[model samples]
Target: MKNLIDYKDDIYKCSRCGLCQTVCPVYKATLNECAVSRGKFNLLNGVIKGDLILNKNLKKYLELCTGCNACKDFCPSRIDVRDIFIAAKAEYYKTNKLSFKEKVLNSYFLFKLVLIVSRFFLPLYRFFRVNKLIKYFENSIKKMGTAAKWLILLNSAAGNGYKPKIRSGSSLKKVLYFDGCFNKYINNETLNSVKKILAQCNVELVTKNFECCGVSYLNDGNIDEFKKIIEKNLSKLDDDFDCIITDCASCYDVLKKYKDYSSDPKAVSLSDNIKMAWDLMKNLEFEALKSYKISVHKPCHDSYEFIDLVKKIKSCEYIEVKDYDKCCGFAGKFALINQNISGKISEQKAQNYIDSDVDIILTTCPACLLGLEQGFAELKLSQNRQKPEIMSLYQFLSSVCKISD
Candidate 1:
């Protein structure tokens, strides 16, 4: 919960290197210096010295970021750009009144209500082409000057009810599995795949009732809600397990931050045990399936360990795209809040995959799956080209391991 003032030194550490311009997805999309870290840092520095005031324009400039941490990684000084932006966003929200739509979207109760309603009515909605109705509603919401178009897009992309059955195993090594909000509500096929693969490796998997990792809340500048959910998750996550596993790269990133965000001793232990499911799968011996060329979309939070695992699969041919490590422009809420910029970036990534002529496009993050899907859909309409199937690394590995559905 550090304020912008707390990050003054970190802000000044930026030497206006402009190296971030080369890696920043939003900056590439908008070509606005304010969209990059160095530019944002300069504005923030001015705010600290009372030369500039925090206004709607400044807030919008900050919101332009995708929270991919690319600038932080590319910085010569290794300045923490994401931390500063997040803190500044939190501070901005503290003084400003949240809009009705923002409050409703970030409310835990409303989220639960929407999840329940979607699960119950999604089939009917899909059958009836509810997106048209949503579009009509969007017109009204837009008239109200709120960004409800994101809600419309999200509703259209909602998955059909696909819950995977959880299986247990008897093994010496104990692992707790954290199914992120996307896996828990929209799709569980990937979670089931993780369980099947882990069972094959003789690792016992444990399940618990965990809340959203608060990454969404943090992105929305709802710090209070984020803290509330984190405390709840920490209470449920005890130190009994040898490792806490997640297939979602975003959840992995957020869970690892709990150590710095909280004072609870379990927070550190839980963060320390946060392991990527693919990291475990890489070492296990498995018979690779029949050969198929595949391209990977490495998630922003990924350490590329999953890419190495994909390469190890026996008969499969791995095709590398030129922008393999670039952001898919779907950094959670970033896709929703900044759809135009997000769509432009996704188009670039998707076009790269389409040009590769790979049979499948693989990624580790569910959000990326949605983003890539959106991109392919847009391209398919414009170019009328045959698009490759987008699958999760878990799904690809499950197929290679021949795990039954």
Candidate 2:
């Protein structure tokens, strides 16, 4: 992993262009120039020159980012803002000792523990009709605090799915599946949906024990922890599989970059064969069970043009909301750490979807799904307005669409 000093050149190349401000969700919400890339580059540039020290105050400014890479994509200098910030954050971790709160916030163990608890209680949550009760008392919860905005996201695990019309055929493709931490821990609805669709295409899935993609660790600049998990994942990567597939955009993004972290030959081969499940579902056709208006929230980690696939669904009308490709502001821990900024950004993005009057809002990543739900929940929408249903794209498809192929 590279250090902050290594990105000195990239920091100096900022050119003080304010173009980044145009796309940064943080800047849009807070209007803090320091919250954007140009401002961050200036601070980093000072640190490189030894004019400023890396302290918690300076580090707080760096954490202002969503790691959405919106500015990176829009940059005229084409600097890698995401990696530079990570490198800088890694620098912070090197010198400063982590506080207990910081440890819990960054702890993937505790994060997964929350999901494990959720999964364990899901049966009781459903059997006692707790989900419905939560929905009934949702408005009361929202009044309690901003954190309560997660009510929709927390209750999202249970939903209806279409019955599989076809059985798995003789294995034609040796596709290894990478079910992300959210799917593996909370529920497998998204993975189940992908498998249902993949079976229609006659693709047999191979499974393996895999850890969290270490995206949070990477974003937190916990490079050592990130690489430890990366090395472990690279160890289990089978070279014989025709391709490794993922339904989560964020996981796909991280898995595709495995070779960047490790030079192991398996890492290179794994990156070579990394594929989004949508690539395999191209020729297959699906139709919604009912006529409804649907829209999509493009995940920041997504590189695939799967929106074309979403638009191709028969019977369901697809509406393109304004700035549908913008970040949902749920950039993992960034949401909790910067709740006000996140809530502000999500509110505006949610309004766009509201204006379009979409019945269902689908995204490829679990975090994005939560982000959308957070946006809607925080709005505490009027009784007159209907909040669109939020779901992972695969879950939405498998639950509402049938294998027309």
Candidate 3:
């Protein structure tokens, strides 16, 4: 878990090829050389060589990256450029303590405390139009040059309800839910839907006493804190489970970072398990999903091995959007911190949806849902059109298939 800047060999191995430019979403939006992997590489090299100090201005350039992993996927060297950037941020944050906001975010106890308080103050948010108030607070954070965003988030927990908790039965098939912070807070419905889908599959769910998946902490470059959270979660999860389920791609990707699982024989995302079960059900001549006109936003974390599943389902007329594998701009903190560039990448994805002529836009992760929904909102405003509905792949499946008792 060394700082990404510490990857001298990987950083030095980068040939400044600029091949990452073709697919980098931020670079496409801002058209700034500094927004892509190569530029960031050069900047980090300067910092390492003492040509540049790791200051806020320099940090902002690194922060502009979405950590979408697109660059690494395309890199000939496969240098893991995204992880390096994340490590660099962690290294920088080590030298520079957490900002007032980040300090609150990284603490589980404080976050839960804020959630408790939010439950009591729910009406106040509703009375004043909370979502707009949140946007106002986000804007205010920018205007006042203060850490109001974290304070606002502290107040806004009840707006989405508390971090979702799953109730488990004593003895049955167990499933672990990797509820990343965002899914716990914003996309509670998907959590609920996952429970329902599990019930239909006859799999009993278990709620592990776990911490956040550390994706946020990892991106913030608080590696030590991130490691601590993962270790704590690993200690709590001693029971056996059929599989681990999560509704966020970024969280799913980060969960794999845990060395504790290096020994576990089985671990898979909820969608992955479903895709496997889907094959079994298909062999049974189960009714195909016929009512929906849908398109899938294959998350970057979903194995490319599953792309054949897409091909299999394609015969049912499930529309596939072009460039669907590209990141949806929900790289945790990236969406919040780099709004304009993030929005542009999101708009492009939304535009693909509009052109696809589908009733619903489907994705595997909750963050993608939020990012795409926001993009659809922007597109609607621009064209005076209504936005398409956003749905998790589970919800889409649950809607089409009836659950048996």
Candidate 4:
């Protein structure tokens, strides 16, 4: 792994342009230059020059980022801002001793344990409206500590751990399906939909004992753990498959960037074969539906041309929302760390969908689904209006393909 100083040139490559400010979700919410890429770059540059120390404040600046890559995407210089931040985070973790709370939150065993418990109690949790309960718990967790906040967020995001039974097809082209953590646990409907859609395409969908994509580890600055999980995942996949497909945009983005973080040859191979589920299904034949007004919340990590593909669908009328490309503010642990900002951004997105007056609000990312759902749920209580149904693109396509859940 490269150190922060190794990316000295990339850090300095920032032209100090403020265009990132316009698109940065955190910056838009906080209106703090320190929350944006350029400001962070300046701080990083200061650290390199020995003018500033990698202290708590400096670390907080890095944490303020949602890692959405919007700044990198909009950068005139095309600097990999997210990459630099990740490197900086790794360096900080290396030099500083992690608090007990940080260590516990980042523990693999604890995460898996929480997942197991959450899955077991999912029915009861939903019955009590756990999503609604999270808002109230947020304040108390903040008062407790950062560790509590992590626990609350992870609990809130836990899914029912439903596994869809996907029957194999007779196609020679084998596509390995990587059901990301969110889809695997909470949103199995999306996975089932993907399987049915792929079956229609005459492609064999394969699955093996795969682990989490280690995105949460990466976001939490646990690079060592992230690499370990990625190595485990790589061992499960082989070159025999035609392509590796993922429905979650964030997972797709992280898988695509695996090569940059790890030197493992398999990481490069795995990333090379990664295909966004929407990219594969858009060209396939499906029965068109009656005209329905639909709005899309494009995930910040969306790299494929899914929106254009959605537009190509004949039956559904795509309603355009103002600032459609804005972040839904569910940047993994970011929503937990900065709930106020996250809630504000999510509410703004929900308002856009409400204003569009659509029958359904569709998104490509699983985490975005949670954010949109929470936002719409809050809107329902406060505004007393009908909240549009939130569905994954896979769900929408499944309906068009007439796949029963």
The numbered model that scores best in lDDT is 2
lDDT of 3 by residue, 274-361 (tens): 2222222232111235655667787777655434543444324567788788888766578778777777898799899788777767
**lDDT per residue as tens, model 2, 151-206:** 65677655332234447468677689987677676667777888877887778777
Cα deviation of 367, candidate 3, in Å: 0.7
TM-score for candidate 1, please give it.
0.87
Give per-residue CA lDDT, model 1, range 275-328, as digits (tens).
988887766755456777888999998798778777766677889987989888
* Candidate 4 residue spans exceeding 4 A from truth: 123-169, 288-290, 377-384, 400-405
Count backbone clashes in candidate 3: 3
TM-score of each model, paired residue for residue:
0.87, 0.95, 0.77, 0.86
Stronger candidate by TM-score (3 vs 4):
4
Model 3's TM-score against the true structure: 0.77
The lDDT of each candidate is: 0.78, 0.83, 0.64, 0.76
Clashes of 4: 1
**Span of ten consecutive residues with least summed lDDT in model 2:** 157-166
Q: Residue 332's C-alpha lDDT in candidate 3? A: 59
lDDT of 4 by residue, 1-405 (tens): 678899999887788869999899899989989999989988999999999988767888898888888888899999888878888888888888887977886798988886667556766776676755775555454346445544554554554333444566577577889986665555467887787777777777777757788887887667989988988898887767768888888888889878877788888988888888877776675445677787788888885378876676666788888877878887877876677787777778888888888888778888888778555543433334566767788877775434322
lDDT, model 3, position 355: 81
Poorest lDDT segment (10 consecutive residues) of candidate 3: 277-286
Query: 367, model 1: CA deviation in Å?
Result: 0.7
| Ranking of all predicted structures according to lDDT, beginning with the best and ending with the worst | 2, 1, 4, 3
Worst 10 residues of 1 by lDDT: 138-147
